[model samples]
Target: MICPRCAASLTAKQRNGRMCAQCGKRFALDPAVHGKGMHDIRIRGIAERATDHGRLKITLTQLWYLSRSRNYAWAGRDPQGVPARIRWLVALPVAAALVACAVLTGGVLAVLAGAAACACVVVASSMRHRPGQSPHAQIIPAEQTFRDLMNGSWSAVYGGLPEGVVDDARPVPRPRGANRSGASVPVSPPKAAILCTDRVVALFLTANGIPARLEAVLVEVADADGTKGRPTVLAAALSAIAQYRSGLPVVVLHDADPQGALLAPLIRGAQPDRVVVDAGLPVSAARNRLGVVRLVRHDRLADAEQLRTVAGLPEADAEWLGEGFWSPLAAVTPRVLESIVVRAVERALAAPRPTHHEALTHGFLTWPQAPRSPRTSRAPGTRPPGTGTYKKKGTSSA
Candidate 1:
């Protein structure tokens, strides 16, 4: 391992006690003591990339995923086969026993030993033929393990977390409605709301003041128990915000999974009068894409039929999701995720505001019209066609 302070290659004896003999500087993390690729320098590089070179802030959970290798193991796949050296060790011993038995006793014992040796050889050959299905199954460390390493070794050595990394486990401060004197304070309604499925993603946005910058409210769909089912609480919050402002738009951000794909459509169905834009991690972006971390969960298998019917997803995407493959939005680099959310919110705010009936009928299919050239003359109290309907008191027009 290279010393983080001096960049000198240090052997185990030289770096004993976590002190670099060359530079005489103590380092926080040793690749040999921790895991491979877990040195301080490597962590700093990953942190820099995850935060876009200090342009954005990322949560500890996001940094953890960023530190992991891109290779992932799918569920239900066969584990890696036994090594050939171990197989040979067992086979050689069995063959020697069989030969000794044949030379010492030409009876049932020799036949039994020969059968045992043949069975051992056959099993070893079969196992050798079976290729390892998932060698990197245990590559990603458990969350708790990573947290302990970071909080213990990393913190002891570095004094704190790397730059631009915030602990998501800490409590986030919510907006207060009352003043210190106990007087009620009036607050203006937000222009839009960003509904996020992941708590860490919400924390990332809120910690970075993305919501305040956009004058938007951040609503996390997941509950305290981390359940990602129907977001009744989020729906009610959106309804309340919409009541405050009649046409408040909603931007939905979610993972690239079956439930995530359906989240936006479900919101649009519940809030038929508002424009709900889905800025989720699409399956297309994760499928077969390098450097994207894909995870599998057998307990939460996707229903292809449900995704196809509710989300109107393509057959290929639906099938891929149905197989229990999912990519987390938090796994995306912090800068990229922030950009995606910002662009989606802008689009939601700019979406055309149609009547309730038009919204229900046309939905997101409605596009904003191009600016029309100014007209020289028009009839009194009249507007151009396709602009909007105008009505006078006690009068109706078709």
Candidate 2:
């Protein structure tokens, strides 16, 4: 491990107290104390990459995935089998015991003992190991374990979390007069909305001011009950926004699981008049992608069956979901995730507004003509053209 404070390679002895012997500077996250590959320098590097060098803010969940040792699925056969050496060790002991018995006992007794020993050796040599049970298998650490390391040890040593990394597990304080039902109160009426299935992703966007920059409301969908009912808060907000600003577009950002696959369709079904863009993590994006975390849950078999009903879901993706595979949006790097969302919002805004009898139509034909430049003189007989200003939205645009 290299000392984060001094840039000097540190031996276990030198970093025994989490202090560098060279500069005598203290640092958090000794690899020995935390899991392998979790030194302070590596943690900082992961945070930097995840946050795009402080240009974006990421949540602890994103940091956890970025810091994982293995992000892709295990290929080929399971690597948890007992070693040949261990099998040989067991076999050798049994063989030696059998040889001793054969030498000490009479003919029939000796033969039976030898046969039993041979069977024992065969069984030992053929012992099958369970998947993910090997000591060498790179299991993902539990979220709580990673959180404890970051919040407890790392904070105690470094004073706080790394820059641009927010702890999503911590409860956000509700503003005064906030709704008790967990619906977020928008500071102002929004032109668009981002509906995220995961609270962590929503929190990441909110922390980084993505919603504010897009002039969009951020709505986090709570875990669904079996009823599969539409979220009333989302419905009310959309209705109210549409009354003031017609054709309010929505961007649905979600994971690559069955529930996520169903979210966009559910919203579209409930609000057929609104434009809902699905900017979610698809199964194809994470299926064979390098360095993306693909998790498995055996309990999602029923959920996978339900995904077949979702419109436009590929058969392969449906089968993958049926097999209980999922990938969280939080697993995406902060910069890339932000880019995807911004592009999706642009698409939503560019989509033609839903037509209503009372609403005035706005399109290429009906758009206002460009105004003459201030420097250009207007004809005396012609009325002054309307002064139209056009501003292009960028990633940093407010």
Candidate 3:
């Protein structure tokens, strides 16, 4: 057992004297015990914490193993000085002397004599070897065990990390001089062309052999200043029309709502006559008819009576109805959207082309559907200020 005072190993004589050899600390055994139950109480507490006290004590013994392992591997500072570098100091001089002696006397005997001298020098050097001044001995195997323990513990800790916690969410790189998807695309076509605001609508038209471009301008205006009984949103609708008349007629595929009406003028330029067509018209009448209509609306507003009669539909149904038309859907429904798209295309095909600015500006009138802030609808893939309520899902709130 190690001495409690100096932590030094106790000798037989030292134990007999009940004192530490290194520190000279005295020890005594208690003569009067508190009670026999004291040992039982201590044993009970120890048993509650551990299945086997001997096992626990043996584990605690590893502290010595750890320290000893470290001691053998690590060199402690020397109290005095480091061991002298004897190998180089002695070997070189001896080798040089032996070589010189061999060179001076060239013969078998002289070479034999040099060889003997070299052997003697090696032996003498080995005899004069000085022990290192460092107090600790190298602990090789023990240090290795400690290192293994540390590595295993760290491995266990690292293996316990949760998956998908840290992702490298880098932005996708687009190609140079191309659209965001990296596809080479043409700019908007002429005013006489049949264009669309939604890509899906354009794709559908293109598939059906219609000459349609996506995101084509339907309107352009100087400003959004106040103008009579119409809501402020009418300006955007008028703008869509102006854009259309400047070149091609457009097919606006949007939600069946007030704001969705803005897209109509954008597709077909405003005409001198405010003529609007719908799917209710005979296919022959709508077909090849060169005019514009707010076709996507569930109901049209011809006057204040019509305007007051209009109301928003169920969000689910509105979205479901929106899907019948082709690409870039702001709505989600699958009913009658195709027919509405076809009617718009037929009307646009039949409309007369605008040649003058006045003609382009003529029948232009704004119908307020949903008054999206100019800021909110600046461009796709952008979030404008105060546009939070209208998300990709297409629901609006105060």
Top candidate (lDDT) = 1
lDDT of 1 by residue, 1-398 (tens): 89999999999999998899998989887777776667889889999988888877788899888887434555444536677888888888888888778778878887887787788788877785345333122335566777887888788888888888877787544334533322222355678877777778887887677776677777666544434444554465455445545577877777887777776776677667778777778676566445667766564434889889988877867877776667788888888787777767677777776445633211111222322223445579965332331232110101
lDDT of each: 0.68, 0.66, 0.33
Report the Cα lDDT for candidate 1: 0.68
Lowest lDDT 10-mer window, candidate 2?
Answer: 357-366
- Give the poorly placed runs of model 1, Cα more than 4 Å off: 77-139, 172-187, 223-228, 231-246, 354-398
Residue 365's lDDT within candidate 1 is 15
Residue 326, model 2: lDDT of 70
The all-Cα superposition gives candidate 1 an RMSD in Å to the true structure of 13.9
TM-score of 1: 0.69
TM-score of 3: 0.23
With candidate 2 superimposed using the best TM-score fit, by how many Å does residue 376's alpha carbon deviate from the native? 37
Could you give candidate 2's per-residue lDDT for residues 1-398 as a string of tens digits? 88888799989988877888889988878767776777888889989988889887788888888887643332222357787777888788888898789889988989988898888788886787654521111335567788898998889988889987877777543433234533344567777887777777777777767776777776766454423433443464345445444467888777777766666675666566777777878666555444557766544533444667754556766776666667778777788788777777776777665433211111111123442233677568765222222333111100
Q: Root-mean-square deviation of each candidate, in angstroms?
A: 13.9, 13.4, 35.3
* Model 2 RMSD in angstroms: 13.4
Model 3 lDDT per residue over 135-196, tens place: 22233234344334323332253341112111112222222233443222335543233323
Score residue 291 of candidate 2 by CA lDDT. 54
